[model samples]
Target: MRRLVIVNQKGGVGKTTTTANLAAALVRRGWRVLLIDMDPQAHLSIHFGFDPESNEPTIYDVLTQGTSVTEILRDTEEGLRLLPACVDLAAAEVELAGVDDRHYLLRNALSPVENEFDAILVDCAPSLGLLTLNALCAGFEVIIPLQPHFLALQGLMKLGQTVALVRARLNPMLRIAGVVVVMQDSGTLLSAEVISGLEQILAAHRRSGDAWGDARIFSTRIRRNIKLAECPSHQTSIFTYAPKSNGALDYAALADELFGTAAAAPVAPADAAPPVAAATTRDPRDAEDAAPSESSMRTATA
Candidate 1:
């Protein structure tokens, strides 16, 4: 299965929204999709009608307690299956702190069911902690959702650095699939400027050629749509909430663009042996101070 991690250290850039809609769109296109919510907030689960307060098993249990992923998996509309998250996941960092090979905990948990899904989308938390590390180690393709803002560019840089580190240490096959601009308003001058800057950066990297192998910026920009924000409140995807809405159309285009090129490749087998020593480093947050408030979830929905 092709594992795609929808990640952005900046929360408001629409990572969760992209994960939800993209999975829905892929399901519509006849792919078996698995959506994994790695955020402690459980926003993805709640968006799909899961209540963390209930007694049902969550991704927290699957990763920390070795619960079977198939047992906790639940089907959604349009044939997407979700591995829900709960608030307890917030404590996983401390709980797994002293454990060995903590970084590969998630990868080990998901290894058994890797072949069950055609596509696995991981919705990561806003911070660069154990949870996000798990996602980086588990997935081969990284899909960064960016907003058209100067600060978002900085966040993207940090995320790119993290991905590079992960590749150097953990997963050698990991690569950035592409960068996606979300909540774009083409009519605004600021948005236009950010777009220009992004293109310049991408073009420079292309000229260098060695920095990025095959990664390219996606052409389908996701426009700000009220329908997209509204759908999560009703626990539905944009397609089910309003199929004709711009939100649905944009996500469908993105899905088409993503799968049209990579659909035929077979999923990689899970890592059977235990992870090596490098994956067990302490939390990156403890070494440095917490990310600035502006870089955290402050702009989560913007």
Candidate 2:
């Protein structure tokens, strides 16, 4: 199975949205997709209309109690299968702190059923904690959701450092497969400048033949859309809630690119204007501090 972890250390960057819609889009194409929500806030679970408070066993049980993954799995109306999350997962980091194989618990738990699906997408919390580490250890590929803002870009280096550590100490196969730009306000010069700066950085890294050589900024950018933000509250994906909307169109294009499938529909042009370099400047220290702490990470989301 193609295991991909959707993560961004800084929150509110459309990490959960990317995970949910990408899984839904892949399932629509007849791929068996399994979504695992590692976020303690349970937003992804609630996005699918499942109450995290319900008595169902969550990924928390699988990690802490060693419960079999198949036992807690649920099928959604959107043709996607989910291994849900709950607010109780917030205690997992503390619970796992004493375990010898703490970082690999998720990887071991998923071994029995990894072959059942064609693709598995893991939705992570907004912190670089034990939970996110488990996810990085379990998956070979990562998709980072980024907002076009100076503060968001500042956390990229920290995330890159963490991924590098995981690759060296845990999963050598792990690699950043793609960088997705989301919640872009096309009218803002700040947004445009941020995107330009990111492109230049990626280009420089590629030229230097660094680890980022294989990572490309996705051609399909998720434009700011009310409908996309509304779908989660309505408990459905963009494809089902507003298939004709621009939000749906962008995600469809993203899915096509991710799956290496022929584009069934032409990608929409980016709505953004040219960037103003001055508007994109920020203090790097302030940007680094924007990442959530473990105490506050549970509430982080897109």
RMSD of 2: 9.7
How far in Å is the alpha carbon of 190 misplaced in model 1? 1.0
Candidate 1: regions farther than 4 A off: 207-212, 261-302
lDDT of all predictions: 0.77, 0.80
What tens digits encode model 1's per-residue C-alpha lDDT throughout 76-174? Answer: 755679999999999998888888888888889888888878889999998888999999899989998888766667766667778878888888778
Candidate 2 lDDT tens digits, 1-302: 68999989877888899999888777766677899999998999999988999978999999999999999898888777899999989999999899999999999999898888888899999899999999999998889988876566777878877887898889988988879988765556766787888787777777543445578898887766667789998899988887766667778778877775532322322441211111112233432223333232123342
- Per-residue lDDT, model 2, residue 157, is 72
Looking at model 2, which ten-residue stretch has the lowest summed lDDT?
272-281
Indicate the residue-level lDDT of 53 in model 2: 95
TM-score of each: 0.84, 0.85
